[model samples]
Target: MTKEENEKRLAYLKSIVARLPEKPGSYQFYDDEHTIIYVGKAKSLKSRVSSYFHTEVDRFKTKVLVSKIHDISYTVVNTEEDALLLENSLIKKYNPRYNVLLKDGKTYPSICITNEPFPRIFKTRTINKKWGTYYGPYSHAASMYAVLDLINKLYKPRTCRQPMTKEGVKAGKYQTCLEYHIKNCLGPCVARQSFEDYQKNIAQAREILKGNTRQILRDMRAEMEQLAEELRFEEAEEVKRKYLLIDSFVSKSEVVSHTIDNVDVFSITNDEKVAYVNYIHVSNGSINQSFTFEYKKRLNETEQELLQLGIIEMRERFNSHSKEIVVPFEPDMELENVVFTVPQRGDKKTLLDLSLMNGKQYKFDRLKQAEKLNPEQKQVRLMKELQEKLGLPKLPYQIECFDNSNISGTDAVAACVVFKSMKPSKKDYKKYNIKTVVGPDDYASMKEVVHRRYSRLLEEEQPLPDLIIADGGKGQMGVIREVIQDELNLDIPIAGLAKNDRHRTNELLYGFPPMSVQLKTDSELFHVLTQIQDEVHRFAITFHREKRSKRALESELDSIKGIGPKTRDGLLNALKSVKKISEANLDTLTDLIGAAKAQIVYDYFHPENTTGES
Candidate 1:
C-alpha cells in the first residue's frame, strides 16, 4: 500500500481498537475480502487487539496478518475460560485461515448403549444424546469392538429393533427371534427375562464401559457363588465364564494406579508445519480412552498454545470433567478446577511418556503414508534434513563419495560413487587405478581421486557435486578438503563416513577439526550415508579384484610367446582354467586352437618333452 493509504488503514484499525472493551473475549481479524482470517482468545480484548497493530509486533506472520486486516470483530465474555471455549467454537465454525486447524476431523466410532425399553449396545459413529450413555468416540475401532464383544458375552442384550416394553411382553405383541434360539439373547421381548434382570445387566454393562470393572467383577463372582450354593451348576458355569471374561479384559488394560482415577494425560509432538497431541483418559486404574490428533499450524503457533487448544477441545468433545491433567509441560491456558502436572517419575510420568510415544507414532505414520503416495517427498525431506544438519548452503542433490581398495599395495584402486537426488547414479560412478599413490596409502589415494573427480568436472564445465564424502574417517576427510578446497579451489562441502571396529558404518564426520555428526542409527539419513559408503567400497573392491585377476591371468598365459589376447581367451574358454590348459595334450589343444598354437602351448607347459617329437 502507498504511504497515505497505509496511514489511513492503520488509523482506521486503531480507531476500531480504541472502541473495544477490556473484557475477556474472542476476536476475529478480517482481510481485504472481508473474510475472517484469524481468531484468538485473550483476557483483555482491547489490549490483545491493540497489541497486533503496535510498532513492536515483530513476528513476521503476525506482521503480515496485521497488514491484511481491513476490519475487526469480537465477542466479550465473562471470564477467560469462556473466551477460550468461544474461540474454539468460532475457529471450528468459520475455519479461519490463521487459526490452528484440527487435521483429524474424523468422527470416530463410539459404543452406544441405546436408551430403549431394553437398551441395545452397539458401535455407532453418529451420536444421539437420547441414546442412553455413549462410552467413547473410540479412535481405534478394535477397542470399541472389544468392549461391545465383552458386553455381548456378558449381558446377551436383545438385538431386535422392536421396542420392548413390559406391557408389550405381557400382551404377547413381540415374539422370540433367532437371536433367542441361538442363545445370543435372553428374549426380554417374550418375557423369558424379567425387566428388572435385564435392567440390572444393562447397569453392569454401563459400569464396564466406564472402566469401573472391579465392582462388576465382584458382583459377578458373588452371583456365580450363589448359583453354585443353590446347586444350579449350568447357571453358575455361565456366570463363571462371564466373570473370567471381565477379569481377562481388566488384565489386558494399562493399569496406572487405583489412586489416579479420572485424570487426563496429554503429550505433544510437533514439526514446523503441524503439531500432534495424544490424549489418554484414565478411569479406575485403567486407560479408558486414548486418541492422537494433529493440528495444521497457522501463524506459527507455539507448542504450548497448540497444546492448550487441544486440551480444551478434547475435554469439551469427550465431556470430560477430569480435574487433574498430566502434561509434559504446563499449557498456556487454565481451566477453573483443573490442575496441570508435569511429573518427573511415577505412574503419571509413565502415562506422559506413553502419550508422547503415541503422538510421535501418529506423526510418523502420517508421514509414511504421505511418502508412500509420493516417494520423492521422503528423498527431498532427507536431503533437507542433511542440509540443515550440516548447515549447508544448498540441498545435497548430488553427492559423491570416494573409497580406496587394495591388498597390501597390490592392485590399488579407488572408486567414486555418485548419488543424485539421494539415489545411486550408477552411470556417474568412476574407477581410478592408483597411479601417483602406490601401496595402501589411503590418504594419498583419496586425495588423488578427489582432485581427479572435481578437476575433470571443472574442466568439462559440468556442475560440481553438492557434497563430497570420504569413505574413511578424519584423516580421509582432511585429505579430501585439502584436495577439493586447497588445490582445486572448489567450495564443495565434504563429509566422512567412519567405520567402527567391526567395519560397520558408525558415525559421520564433517567440518574443520571434524566433530562427529550425531545421527540416529536407524534413521534414513544414516541409512543413505551408509549406502553411499558401502557402494563406493563395493565398487572400489570389485575394481581392485578385477585388476588383480587380469594381472594373474597375464602372468600365467600372457607370457606365452605365440599366445595373443584372442589365443589366450580361446584357450581359457575351451579348457576353463590355466591348470586345465596345462593339463591338455597337443591333440586337445589343436581342436581348440590351431596346431601351431597348440604346439606352443604344449611346449610352454611341458618343457620336459618336445610335443611333436613324441
Candidate 2:
C-alpha cells in the first residue's frame, strides 16, 4: 500500500516482463498470491509490456490493472496472428477474473446419422467421421429432439435396437415395433424399406441444411399434385404438410442475403488484459445466429490479427461446412475458398462494420459481468457470512447439509446436499433411504444419513466438508456428532437449522447455547446457504414421498393372501396401480392373475375379508 511497496511490486513486474522476447507472444499477469489475474497476447511484446509502465496513460481501467500487477510472464511466438491465437487458448484455460468470460458451458446438440450397415440417425453431443454425418451443434437439445421426432414420423426409420438384415425379413425373425403401428417408423430392421430409398431421404435432409430448401419444396409440391391427381388424397395431404413446414423454416430465415451465399463474420474488442471475440454465421446473407468467445490473456497482436486467428481456430473446431470467412479485421490465413476482407465501402462493408460494433457491445456486456461477483466469489462470501453467523473456525465454503423426510414412519428417506465454496453442488447431492430406522424418530434417521454420506467420503479419501448442517435442533446435531466423532472419528463443524412455527428457516443451533444469528437478505452468501438448505430438504422429501407411495401400494397387495412377490409384481405390471386392480372384473383378473388366483383375490376383497380374512 505504501510507495516503497508499490515500487517493489512494479520492479518485480518489470524484471519478469523484461525477460520476454520482442516477437509476437502471449503474456500472463499474476497477483500477490501467484494466482493468474490476467492473460493477453501482443504483436510486439516490448511495446505492449512497456505500455503498462506508463503512468500518464489516463486510462482508469489500465491504472487499476497496473496497481494490481505483482508479476508478469510471456511466451514468444512466430507471428502476431499466432500470438493472437495463443492468447485466446490460454485465456480459456486460465479463466482469469478480469477477462471477458463465456460463462455458459452448455454443449450444443448435433444430429448424427450412423455410418454403420444400418445407418440410423441419432442425437449426440460429440461429432466425428467414425460415427457418421453430423448436421449441427444446435443451440438446444429440444431442437435436435424435434428433428428426431419428425424424422421418425415421416421416414419411419427403425427405433428398435435390432440389427437390420434381408435374411431377418425373409425369415420373419423380427416383429415390427410399436413405432410402426403408431406410424412413427419405417421399420427398416424388418426390411420393409429399401436402403436406396433411405439414402434418398438422407440426401434430401442434407440438401435442406445446405439452404436448398426451395428445390426440395418444389419437388414435394410436384409430388403432392401428382398424388392428388391420382386420387391419393391422404398421401398428397402428408406431402403438402412437409412442403408447408419447409416453407415456414425458410421464411423464418429472413436475414439470408442473396449476395452473401456462405460466410462467417468475426470481430474482436479488448480491454487491457481481456479480449472478446464475437462471431456471426452469415449463410446466404441471413444472420441466423451469433456467439461470443472470450480470452483472458493479453494479446501482443493487433485487433485485426487476433480476429483472423480466431476465425481460423473456430473454423477448424467448428463450421466445417462454411465456405467463406468475412471479418472487419484483416485475416492472415491463406485458407483456400476463404476470403478475408475489410470492407472499406459499400453495403457489404457496412455489414462488416456493424459486426465489429456488435463485438464492442458484447465486450461492454462482459465488462458489466466482470463488475459483478461471480458464482465462486458469491459462494465464498456466503460461506464467510455463514461462518460468522454460526460462529465457526473458518468460512464454511464446503458445507454438507442433511434432511430426512417420511410419512407416518414409513418409506423414510434422507438427503445430503454439498455446498462447495458456498454454492450448492447439485451434482454432489445424494439421497438415501433410512434402511435401519423403523419409526418416525428423526434423530436416528439423521445419524444413518450422515453416517452413510461421510462413510463413503472417508472411504474414498475425499476432502471433508468444513461444516455440516442437520435439519432438526439439538437432537439431530447430537446424533451427527456421535456418528462423526465416535464412529467416523472426524472433527467437522456441525450445525442444525430449527424451523419456526411457520415452517420457515429459523434459528441456527451448533455448539451449546444455540446461537441465533440472522443473515443479510441481500448478501450472495445467504442466498447460497438458503439454496443448499432448500435443495437438501426438497431432495429428502421427494425421495420420502416416492418411497411412501411404493410402500403404500405394496401394503395394499400384501393384505391379499396367495399373492407372493412375483404374483404381486406381475399384477402391478399388468394393472399399473392398486386402484385398477381394486376395480377389475373377474374376466380382467382371470386374464392377469390366472383362474386359480383370481377366485382367491375376488374372495379376499369380497365380503369374507371384511371380517379379517386373508
Candidate 3:
C-alpha cells in the first residue's frame, strides 16, 4: 500500500480500537471490500486490537494484514472460554482468510447405528441425528470395516434397510430376506427374535464401539459358563465364539497399559505453510481412535495456538471426556476439569512419540502428494533446504560445482558443472585445460579454473551462480574462497563435499573455517549434493580422457615430417588403428594414400628397410 493510504488505514483502525470495550470477545478485521479477512479471540478486545496498531508490530505478515484492514468489528462475551467458542464457531462459519483452515472430514465414512426399533448398523458418509449414534468419520476405511466385521460376527445385527415398527412386526408387514436364510440375521422383521434380546445385543455392540470391550468380555464369559452348566452346549459354543472375537479385536489395538485409561494424546508439527496435528484417543488402555489432520496456516501461528485449537476440535469431534490429556508441550489455554501432562518418560511419553510420528508421516504424505501434482515444487523445496542448511542468504537456484582430473599430470583438465533448480544443465557445463598450473597440483589447478571461470562471467556481466561447490574437502573450499573472495573480491557463497574413507560423499562443508553440515545419506538433499559431485567428476574425467587420446594420436602421426593433416586423415580413415597403419605394407599404404605420403609413412615405420636401401 502507499504510505499515505497505510497511515490512513492505521488511523481508522486506531479510532475503532479506542472505542472497543475491554471485555473478553472475538474481533473481526475487514478489508477494503468490506469482507472479513481475520478473526481472533482476546481477553480484552481493546487491548488486543490496540496492540496491532502499535509501532512495535514488526512481523511482515501481520503488517500486511493490518494494512489491508478497512474496518474492525467485535463481539462482547462473558468469559474467555465463551470468546474461544465464539471464535471457533465464527471461523467455521465465515472461514476468514487469516484463520487456520481445518480440512473437513465430511467425506470420510462413519459407522452409524440406525435409530429404528431394530437399529441396523452400517457404514455411512452422512450424519443425521435422527439416524442413531455415529461412532466415527473413519479416515481409514479398512479399520472401520474391521470394527464393523467384528460387530457382525459377535452381535449379528440386522443389515437390512426395512423400517420395522412394533405394529408392523405383529402384522407381518415385513418378510424375512436372504439374510435370515443365510443365518446372518435372526429374522427380527418377523419377530422371531424377542425385542429385549435384540436390544441387549445392540447395547453390547455400542459398548464395543465405545472401546469398552473388557466388561463385555467378562459378561460373555459368565453367560457362556451358565449356558454350559444348564446343558445348553450349542448356545455355550456360540457365546465362546463371540468372546474370542472380541478378545482378538482388543488384542490388535495398541495397548499402552491397563493402569492408564481414558486418556487423550496429541502431537503437533508444521512446515512453512501448514500445521499437522495427530490425535490418538485411548480408552481402557487401548487406542480407540487415531487420526492425523492438517491446518493450512494463514498467519504465523505458533505451535501452541495450533495445538490448542486442535485439542478442542478433536475432543469435540470424538466426544472425549477424558480428565487427562497427554501432549508434547503444555498448551496456552486451560479447561476447568482437564489436566494436560507433558510426559518425559514411560508409556505416556511413548504414546506422545507415537502421535508425533504419525503427525510427521502425515505431513510427509501430504508433501509427496503436492510434489506429484507440481513436480517443480520438489525442486524448489530442495533448493530451500539447501539454502537453509548452508546458511546462504538466498535460495541456491543456480549451483556450480568444480572438479579437477589428471593421470600423472599427462592431460590435466578441470570441469565445472552447472545445476539450475537442482538439475544438471549440460549446456552451461564448461571444460578447461590446465594452462598456468602444471602437474597434478589440484589446489593450483582449481585456483586457476575458479579465477578464469568467474573473471569471464563478471567481465561479460553474466549472472553468477548462487552457490559454488568444490568437489573436495575443506582445503579445496579454501582454495576457491581465496580466488573468488580474496582476489576477485566477489561475494559468492562457496561449499565443499567431504568424502569418507570409502570415497563416498559423507557430509557438506561450509563457511570460512568450513564446518561440516551433516545430511542424512538417504535424504533427497544428500542425493542432490552427491549428484552435483558425481556430474563434475564425470565431466572432468571424460574431458581428460578425450584430451589424452587426442595428444597420443597427434604424437604418433604429427611427429612424422611429411605426414601433413590431410595425409594423416587419409591414412587414419583407411587404417582405423595406429597399429594397423604401422603394420601396413607399402602397396596397401600407397593404395590408401598417394605414393609420396605412403613412402614417408612406410619409411618411418620400417626404419631398418630405409637403412638397408640407403
Candidate with best TM-score? 1
Ranking by lDDT: 3, 1, 2
User: Which scores higher on TM-score, 2 or 3?
Assistant: 3
TM-score for predicted model 1 compared with the true structure = 0.90
Count of clashing residue pairs in every prediction: 0, 22, 0
Q: What lDDT does candidate 3 reach at residue 341?
A: 99
lDDT per prediction?
0.88, 0.72, 0.89
- Candidate closest to the true structure, highest lDDT: 3
lDDT of predicted model 3:
0.89
Over 1-614, each residue of candidate 1 has an lDDT whose tens digit, in order, gives 79999889889989999999989999999998899999999989998888988887788988888889999999999988899999999999999988888975347888888878788888888777876777788877788888888889888998888877788889999988999999999989888899999999999898898788987888888999999999999999988998999999999888888878899999999899999989999988899889987899878899888998998888887788989999998777778988999999998999999999989998999899999999999999999999988989999999998888888988888898999999999999999988998678888887887787888889999989999888878898888889887898889898888889998878888899998988888988999899888888798889988898878987899999978999998888887788999999899999999899899999999998964544
User: Over 4 Å off in model 2, which ranges?
Assistant: 1-9, 67-71, 105-156, 160-175, 195-200, 203-207, 210-252, 266-279, 284-317, 320-614
Q: Cα lDDT of model 2 overall?
A: 0.72
Write the residue-wise lDDT of candidate 3 on 292-341 in tens digits: 87899888988988987888788888888999999998887777688999
At residue 478, what lDDT does model 3 achieve? 92
TM-score winner between 1 and 3, please give it.
Answer: 1
Error of 1 at 588 (Å): 9.6
Residue range 1-614, candidate 2, lDDT tens digits = 89999888888777776776778888888888888888776778878888888767776666777788787888888876577667778766888766545433237666777775656777777767786877666553554565566555556555566766666666878788788888777766566777677777777776664456667877999999999999999989988887877677667654545677666777787765666776766655565445566655432435655565467556654554566666765655445555576667865666676677777877766555654746454445456667777778877767788888877787778888887775567898888878898889888888887888889999899889998887777778788899999998998987777777988765667675456557554555445556677888788888877777888899889988888988888989998998888778778889987998987776666654545538
